[model samples]
Target: MKKFLMLLLALLTVMVIAACTANEDAGEDPTDSEEPDTTEEGTNDDDEDATDDGTEEKVLRLNNGIEPSSLDPSIGFDAVSWDPLNNLMEGLTRLDQDSRAAEGVAESWDISDDGLTYTFHLREDVNWSNGDPVVAEDFVFAWKYMLDPETASPAAFLGYFIEGAEAFNSGEGSADDVNITAVDEKTLEVVLEAPTGFFLDLLTNPAFFPINHQVAQDNPNWHTEAESFVGNGPFKLESWEHDVEMVFTKNEHYWDADTVKLDKVHFAMVNDSNTQYQMFESGELDTASIPPELSDELIDGDNVFIGDYGGLEFYRFNITEEPFHNKNIRKAFAYAVNRADIAEYVVKNGVEPAYGFVSPGFTSPTGSDFRDENGDLVTFNPELAQQYLEDGMAEEGYNELPEIVLTYNTSDSNKAVAEALQSMFNEHLGVEVTLENQEWNVFAEAQQNLELQFSRSSFINDYSDPVNFLESFVTDSYMNRTGFSSAEYDELIEKGKSETDEEQRWEYLYEAERMLAEEMIAMPIRYYNTVVLEADGVSGILRHPVGYFDLKFADKN
Candidate 1:
């Protein structure tokens, strides 16, 4: 009897040991694969983000570079390329899918019959990242600060529509003269010079977005560093390592957190297109955006990639002084560039050659006959370009040829494009072209100051409107690096906006585009479809027309 009892106890112990081993093997974790199980529970690699019961947590990764240019929306504007600022920061209004102005922070709005006064209604429950109530004063402060010439904001032109804004931006009046006030806590009123249809859409931009006035004042460099700022959108910046990596975490205080799928997002700022492709190849990255040159391999996996998106890539010449000041000189330079070769040999397929100022498929309620009446694309004619160069030089009273400098971003692709242009201009037009290379940030600074000669310039539009692109060179426009002003352009632009008839408006705009293109005030090359890489298990991310995507909606498997 004793022997039988001992044998039964041994058998029971063996069964218990077997059951424990099975549980350990089955309950493996995903993250633990990267690290050993040193914790007390000896959790599996995948279980790092999961609960003991195996329910997983959600996080995402996104790769972004540089901190924001400015937190003061009204002043340091241009969030088109750097869209997280525009996406994360809620404005008085927002844009709907149809690209029309819609409600966002403002529930609704009213305009006075006079056609000059505008009012906006704020959302009641909106809260800042620090849990501060978002209110009317935030906008007022942002406006006043931006308009203050002392602020030295790069986007000061955004304030031009407002009454007294021009004088204020021009340093005639204090930023205080620009009148925006709160009728009460929720109601805010603004007075503009005229009734502008684009004003509402402008408000939807980050340039007019309300900021936590106190926070912005407290952290002057908030946007330059990741830790110092806050976001009202679905995600808040979690970590940033310039030129390296960036991470974002879901904002719990977000007004719409339920729809915010990713709990965390990580981004790797890869400079090389090839290296970026490698990361996508290894499945380490969910999406990779590359120039057309690198997309040939991606063509095989049509299910894994999508390439067509609207954007423009063009060269900008400084028309403020020297040789470029002459219209024909600018025209001559434009004629020298062969955008077709670049798009075909450099970028791959899906991007069409840009023959007009505004790209096709890009539209606004305003008309889009931006091409000539002939319905023909602009052509590259070396002989005509040479004629212009000779005429410009003769008109300038210069018998000697002047050496022109072209500035470009130091990226390999950009340099290659610049080199092609250099060869074209020198070989055919008999112009000596000097090349200057700088980093992107420095390039932006130079552009803002009109310090660059012919700059490798093409930025995604802030809004899809032709006005957004054409109006960029408007007199006193912030993005107008060319410094070329035309009375005809100003008149046509004003007429286009003020005309009640849609056909007349289009007529005015088309007239203006023709003049601008013919004058060669600013060179327009080809529009490009943004190329983005897609990875499995990342979903719900949306890319804006301006080449920005939000990973806050993306979820990892």
Candidate 2:
């Protein structure tokens, strides 16, 4: 029994020693066996740390107000396009925070003493997002494209300052006759028909922006999609989901890309101010326009801002149509509205009743505002309105008034203003009007097609010049959706454009403004106020006086 016990103990000890040896063979070094700590945050190399909570940068959330009709600079002519284009593309010059002309693609420029010739020196370091060198010929191509009748750009009139541009647009001259020339790869020269003081300011507009010549030639639809959308600005289109949201990512190839702080910019197309405000409250938006319902409560708040946007809200009569064709009918409709009440009640954001087309911010030769110099030339007098309506009714030989349709873009604020105008027309002129609402693009198309009798419209300056407002009234102006034209008005504006003396030019413009008010060209409603809501941590955002809200210079805290 003793011998058997000893042998079993030795065998057990041998088995234990074999198990220990196997464990030693399977063991690993501590440095190699320790698990990796993925929880320690690390940057993504693909986007260069564009993650939401990364240490590098945050995305800027913005509201575009309306879905832009097109991203093509030659095709887009309104604030909806201009605002985004200002960041996505650049002109020879661009507007700074104060709406002053600033250097853009052109590093510097020299202007002749007569102001008829401008020579631009472009930066050699600049290239398109696609890596193509941006050259002077690009500007020449863009200018010619804008003036080409085939392009049918609504902003074709903007090219009129160039020598022979009018003749080219009118089909009387060749595109080659337009005096824009590329002296070299880095130099661009422009010759104007007359000395224009605001030429640099005009160049800041998107109509004068450059396009990649090869890209445009390769794909006519390149601008319509993100995959093909190439730009040379601080931001480039990453994704464009039509009518919903547009996303812009920073262009790593931009010459000044180092200065761009935001990783991306997201533009949410929320047409309704109420919806935009809700998004703002939900932290989905960084900026929004104050809804008319919330205007009174938020107008004085710290984040709410009111801008003296150099624009006027007006309802234009389709002068080519039946009753509106008569001057007396148009005048009667113009005088019928109580503009002050509308401004105070309907659009309660800081908008003032606009008695004339020119808003109050423009300075005259004597340093007084043009609007202050001409105070309320078109007054609100119901008696005169009724009398004029009666005369129009008599002239038309109609005992029954025609049904008028007032069309406006879809929005709570627009609907409110339309309802107020409807009530005013019913009360003051005994006219029954129908209010029609459509989406912004649809309404814009209808206006462009002249399919609406009366449509709500507004003019934000393309530049600070008064001609930017008055030029739309010219007979052939593509911006003239109203079809209201006069030879005298066109002649006066032509003289104003060429007039060199400051006082003389202002006098011409003043006369034109008087003519507009006296003839009751359109039913001027109110001058626009900025009226916006800004979230915390947003700084350096520029709300241009002409209604362009840009974020290229903005920073997110």
Residue pairs of candidate 2 with colliding backbone atoms: 307-530
Whole-model lDDT values for every prediction: 0.62, 0.76
Worst 10 residues of 1 by lDDT: 33-42
| Model 2 residue 494 distance off true place after TM-score fit, in angstroms | 0.2
Residue-level lDDT of model 2, residues 270-332, one tens digit each, is: 554555566677677777776555566778999876666778788888988878887888888
Query: Residue-wise lDDT of candidate 1 within 148-199, one digit each (tens)?
Result: 8787766566677798887987879876678788787788899987767678
Off by over 4 Å in 1: 1-54, 65-67, 71-81, 97-99, 303-311, 362-377, 394-400, 430-432
Q: Which candidate leads in TM-score?
A: 2
Which residue runs of candidate 2 sit more than 4 Å off their true CA positions? 1-56
